[model samples]
Target: MRQAGLTEALSGLDALGRIWRRRGVFAIVAGAVLALAVAALVLLPVRYLATASVIIAEQEPGANTSAAWAQKVGDPADMESQLLVIRSPRLLRQIISSPGVAGAVVSECERGRLLGSTDACQRLKTDVGAFIDHVESRFSVASAGRSRVINISYQSGLPDVAQTLANALTQTFLEDQRTEGANSREVASSWLWQELKQLDQQLREADDKIQKFRRTKGLMRGANAPISSERLTSIGQQLSQAEAARAEAAARLQEIKSEQERGPTDAPSVLQSRTIADLKQQLTTVSAQLASAAGVLGPKHPSILALTREQASIQQRLVEEMQSIAASAQKAFDANTALVNSLKKQMETAKAEAGSATLDEASIESMVRDTEIKRQQYAELYKKASELETERRVLRGSTRLVSLAELPSKPFFPKKIPFLAAGMTLALIFGVGAALLADQLGARLISPPVPVTPEAPAQQVEAPAADEAPAIVPELAESVTAPETATPPPERSSHLPSVADVSILACLPRLKSLREMSALGAILQGHQPLAIPRVLRLASEDTDFQHALRDLVHELGLKRSARSQRIVVTSPDAGDGKTTTACALAEHLAAAGRRVLVVECDVSHPAFAEIMALPASPGWLGALERGTPLRDMILPTAHPSLDVLPIGATTGPVGDILDAISLDGLLAGLDGYDAVIVDTPLPSQRNDFLAGTDWAIVCVRSDRSLIEPAVVTVNRSRALGARDVGIVVTMTDVEHRSPPVVQTAPVAAYAGAG
Candidate 1:
């Protein structure tokens, strides 16, 4: 994990390094920010401050009230309210409007003496609001530790002026608070009055509802079920009493009636009657006399007759008394019957009243309960309204002043050290941020550009005045040796050194067009057009080819001076026209009336042998077999001066020709030739024979050459004894501006095919 973290850290550093590599952009941004920081340090001014403090007491609701419901606790809301009140606009304006305030400000201005002219003083006198605003702008109020103590501060150029403003503002705030309290009370009283009246109306409405419901339901109000129940109890008691009376009366009536029905003997009241008793007593006496008379008269007639009259009168008197007793009993019976009927009627009336009272009791109780609830709510609201009214009358401001502001001895702003430090910190932060952004944007633009079409070569940006000038990429400092222009192909006129001094020459481009191909062919075939033809060899008389070849000779310093005549041509890889160039060069040199010899040295892919129509015999081996003198091996071509020495089918490796065979004797056979061109294999294939050659020219296929391999080939040949070496391009595709020339008529192979 630690190793991974280190890798990640290194990767991040690499990314940042790439970004910071755009040093020009980073320097400009960072330098500009740093300059600004210095300017800020130089130009910033200082400011002074004076501080004041005011104690703002927190208000508690209903502090003076004795009722538990009216009491209150400490509130953050009230403290915030006090703060607002202190900073109120009306209060500030009032401070401005105070006596001597304008004079004090103008005097301070004049005394400070920035503008001493009387006109300036007069102008300052008129703008009291400006002074107020100036003071207010610098003023700040803050409380510490949630305490009642608030610190009021103001900054100004002058300490005395700042102090004066703070004290005046504090006084004004105090006055405003008191005035605000009074106004608040008035507003509260008005609101409470309206609310209290509303509560009263609600109470009245409740009472009215109770009264109306009682009247409508015919129920007793105020007292509820208890009244109805008590009435019912009274009625029930009366009914019971009436029933008892009626029962007693009924019993007496029944007894009286039975007595009347069974006569006075069955009734005690009849028997106890005063008139009946008196009459019975008399009748008893009369009956005794009659009995006596009847008994005597029955026996003796006159005396018995008188006695019988007496007895009969006594009997009549007794009958009359019994009749009187029966009459009294009838009267008593009638009185008892009337009393029972009256009691029964009274009981029924009392029962009906109780039944009606029961329904009235239920409705009245519900209405009374409802009214009581309304009364309770109305009472609560009324009490609150009254308390609010009382509060409105007696309340005062809750906040107070603790201490007034004093003059400050020190400046509060534009601290030199801190400001400078902050400026530098911020500048660095912003500078780094900008550099990162620029780098990121540049990365986005670095996507692969579209491939440039084949047109005129691209132009380079102008170099700086001095070599030491900073480059966009520092890595490009060592590339000054390359020519800063369009470089042409080097095959025809290789920009080479003298034949004695040269190793490798410049490279060339591929030839695709007929013009370039023909020009190249002409250079190979020389001014003399061969009678023999193969492929494009017929069009060998090209003016451009001759001009370019002359230029090559001039660069080599070989047109006038020659160190060696034996030159070999080879490529790092095949298909590079090595044999063709060698064969053509020999022909051109021979056409100038020089004895030129051409050899097909490449054992494998022997192209020169095929084109020359040579028989299957290695030229060097046969020349050796022809005996001591080697003249017969040097063969002639169709041209008067050129010769072809084709490598034959030896059926063995070509190294024998380079190393095992007599290399000196082989060249001795060419002593009569003025120029010799050898077509050799790639240096990598067989380099021993290439080293024996006097000069070497490497042929590079322009369209398909690898730079590293070509360079390796050049260096390797130089390392060998063939120090005079040059490079030539073949098969290039470009503008064909050179025209071919008509020199000789067409001919067969085996003639002028150097």
Candidate 2:
């Protein structure tokens, strides 16, 4: 009864079996799809691919060692940039317009013309630009991994055309790189030469400016410095020498004055004089003669008087010579002082001249520095220009063609084997899907077979009167006199089994059996067969039905752990006894000392109120529309523990109301019940209410329901979040039914049952 895993496996197998039964349809669909695929593959034009490889030469000619090392490592970004360059519109335009490429394009167009593709041929004849663009679109450039190799691939309907275009593109790209490099270097050399000429002129202008500034400001150079600075230095040195001479002369004059005060004989000029020395010697001799004569001759001494007069004459002469020497020293001091004063005046004049020339000299020095810088720049540019001119003559391209594109022997597209395999796979999938869809649509569209009832034989009775039985008297008398021989019922063939025998009813749990009751049938004669009172009366009269419902309740209790369980009872189709089963199950649960609430969610065709003989009061829909609490709308039943919330009166769209209504919220509001049994419409109609419920019981009629739809309903319930799901077969022949047995069996066993 709880074989969920087994149920899913059997359901899959049953679906496959059903699909297999429609193999004719599958074959037709698959064959059609495969035929279409083959046609498309055959109609598609074959294209040939040609590839040419080129190695990006990392180290260019005349590159330095360090530059070569860096280029060898190769930057991926640089490689990407090169790829873009190869694919650039300008480069592509150049390549496509070349003579070789144009010839190839013409050939391809001619080939297309023969194949009935006149559009490309017309474009070529009428518009050259569009033709070129069309040709460029056929080729692509991409780097080969992280290496410095680029692959130029061209695709066309003709193999030779593809090869020719690919090779031409490669050759053109290499030539373009070389031309671009040479043109860039030539332009640079020309610009450098012009710059060098301008610098040379500027240097000459600066030199002339410096010279003109010096001449205007009298800043003429003298050995190491300007003339004004040299003159000032010379004046300073002469003034120093004049001041020394003046100081020496003043000391001598002062010494002469001191000597005149103490007697002019002590003066240096007087001491060095020869005239004074000769007079001093004569004075000494005369004094010595006077002394000797006075000592020899007494009192009269005529000779001593003569000697004294001679010595006095010599002293007078010596004083005159000293006076002359002092006059000369005064004259020398006056001359030296006048020279020092004159030198000082000249030094002031030189300093004033030097200060005026300082600004002029600074300006000249700045101009000379500018001239030197220009000269250096001119020399450098001239050298670079010469080198560039030399290198430009020998410029080499940075790429070389490694291999020419080869003409492809086979077409690249419409590969027969792989395309066939893929087409077959897709065809099978589409075929299976179509077959299943057709089968499901057929099942839903075709009506189920009506149950056949054998006609009852008419009884014959005595004729009441000739006139009353005038029309049927002969027939009744003949029937009563006829023999009791009746044709034997046709024997059923053993080869073909009845649908009921192989039905999925055996796979599902047989929940309940109620023998056809004449009394219950009489009560439900003019009303719905699932009328509430009829189900109630059947439950009370049928002992096995009560035990089956009790067993269902016990199974629910064992499977669920929630304190309050929410169970949804639904069927694959309407009138499958879902309402009866829901009500009966709820009653049994309530009878088992558990409070149960029955929520009738089938608002589209509500019957609980009318069938249960309850008053027509507003139920869940009206309460929801009026913003009334659902608990207040819950109607009490005969069983104190059982309650019913019927789909109330409403004029609103039942589908919209059901979709917008929150079943969980409604149940939560009616809180006191231990279990809530939600009786929903057929699962095929409305299954949203099954989400978040504890269990789903799908009811099916054993006489009419098929295995595929019932299994689908069970699986759908599980998919919609029903924690536990099971099927309950209803409307069985209770008289001939055996006692209920709960066990698992293979689907093969059931299929083979008689």
Candidate 3:
């Protein structure tokens, strides 16, 4: 597990190293990209910005103008409305048509088109609409942070132009607001004046109608207040008073009459008579004189009698005046009673006139009140009209300017630090992307396409050539041969494929020392080939490698019990010790007394002739061309029961020699061999040359072979009739190298599944 993990880590490192090595390939191109980015940042036009702010004050109570319709300050809706007014097209058009604003926008456009071939700048110079659009695109209006202030901002390449345009827009907005306000006031005044005239006419009609109603109702005016039903009530009250006065006078007169009936002097008025008072005073004076005379003369004196007579006369006159007073009182009582009756009839007449008129006193009173209300309304309308007329001349809008735009000292955009930073970041990304693209294009240009084999129709052998050998039954062919000399031993810690799909027949250890070979007896299990017979002894050597090799050979014999046992050996790529593996397996079987043949079909880089130290000759090919017996072509090997058959003369790129001689006939000639092993080059390259073999001994270079291509080769071998395949992994230097696994086991079985 540790070894496999190390192998994956090493593979990842190798991939990274390959990528790192290509870093310099695109460095110059990437630097040019960055340089262009820097130039763009430096050469692009800079723009200046200017802002003007205005505050929208809250409306005061009791105000009656357009300003009064405004909401309180600090309200979002109110702030938004102010911004809307500033940004309105009508106001914007006025600002755009300002004396210098349009010219500045055109100039900016002309500057922007300096490098272009088009006459857009020339066209815009004469067009106000294009200038206005440009101005609007650069201008911005927004409320300032939840406040009632609205900010008007403008951007331009020229600092003075930005400031002038901003100030102009703010000023234009204010003037437009004032103009609208004045127009609104004038309209309101006109409407109010017309209303006042109508109200005045209504009031006059109401007053005149009230008078006509009073005349029809017979409700006359009183001395203090108007006379209506209350007048009738007053008349009734007067009648009642007159009746009460007449009753009191009559009662006094009756008492006086009673007194007069009893005696003239008994009358109350006579008792209170002024004539009796004066006459009594005179009689007293006369009685005083008579008493003086009687005192001097006799009791019947003339002076005394005269005094008495005068007193009686005064008493008589008093009685007469009392009677007269009582009669006057009776006359007064009668006149008062008649006056009361007249007043009561007058009251009844007034009520009858009011009732007959079909206008009740209450109705008349309501009419009077309504008429007064009309007069009051007319007066109020007159006052409001006058006020609006005066206000129309002086009314200002709700918007007030808090500040005007100032000239900008610095450009708002194309700042040095920020632009450079942003440009650098973008250039870095594009540079890397461009570099990778260039590398890919270069690789595609450098490599050529490899030709893949097409699916050919099934056939054992092609027609014989001019130098042909006789054809024979391919099934009658015996198995292959082995080499005379020993091949290279399997390296240490060798990786082998799994024994599941393809049984790994052998996994030999590295023969680093005598200690490593001490357990050779156990690994060979008494079947050590004569090619490697001398076993060096060691002191207490580790035998784990012995168990591994023993287990491999045991598994091969146990698993490979089926028919069609002719084994073909190949690799996915070269340098996998393909020939060495075939030779070793054949040697092991032959030394065990099982007759084996190892045929070297790989003429391009054949190892069998070299390993046997063969003299230069045509090998099997020359013998066939010479029509020599097939038995003589079979060369003896160092192993008593093993033999080698080399591919003669070098086969051309097309390998046409194999077509001239019957490979099946040659194999059939090996009738005595117990088993056959054919050593060939990569199967994928040769295509399907060894299709007759039932099983394969595929060699894999441990820690180096790509499993995917190896798997492809194995699958292709299966398609070409090699079944019951076995793998022999070689050159595995696991003790010191990476990917130190014992075998190139099935990828899924070893990939963390356990």
Best by lDDT: 2
Task: Assess the local accuracy of residue 31 in candidate 2 as a C-alpha lDDT between 0 and 100.
Answer: 94
Deviation (Å) of 211 in candidate 1: 13
Please give, for residues 1-754, the per-residue lDDT of candidate 1 as tens digits: 1223433454567557755786667677777887887787666555677777777653635545445422322345655676676676666666666666666566655755655475555455566566556456677876656666777777766677778777887888877666777687667767766766776777678778767866665555335544445565665676566566556555655665676566544366545666656656665776676677776566467766665666667556645655665565455556655655665575577567657766776666786787677667767766766776666566655657788877787777777678778877877677677777887688679843333332312222122222112111112213212223322223333222211222223222222224545777746643332232243252145434443343334434444545447787877777666766676666656555567778766766766556765555547655555443445555666787777776554444445455444233466645766666777754443345554665677776544413445555665665544646665644432231111111322333223433
| lDDT per residue (tens digit) for residues 93-185 in model 3 | 777667787666667776777687546665655665765666778889988876778899998888888888899999998888778877987
What lDDT score belongs to each candidate, Candidate 1 first? 0.57, 0.69, 0.61
Runs of candidate 1 exceeding 4 Å displacement:
1-46, 51-59, 63-89, 98-104, 111-113, 116-128, 140-152, 170-178, 194-243, 259-382, 393-406, 419-754
lDDT of 1 at 663: 32
Model 3 ranges with Cα > 4 A deviation: 1-33, 56-72, 75-92, 115-128, 212-220, 227-249, 256-270, 274-364, 379-391, 424-754
Candidate 2 C-alpha lDDT tens digits along 311-347:
7888888877777877988999999899999999999
Model 2 residue 38 lDDT score: 99
lDDT of 2: 0.69
Ranking 2 against 3 by lDDT, winner: 2
lDDT score, candidate 1: 0.57
TM-scores for all predictions: 0.37, 0.53, 0.48
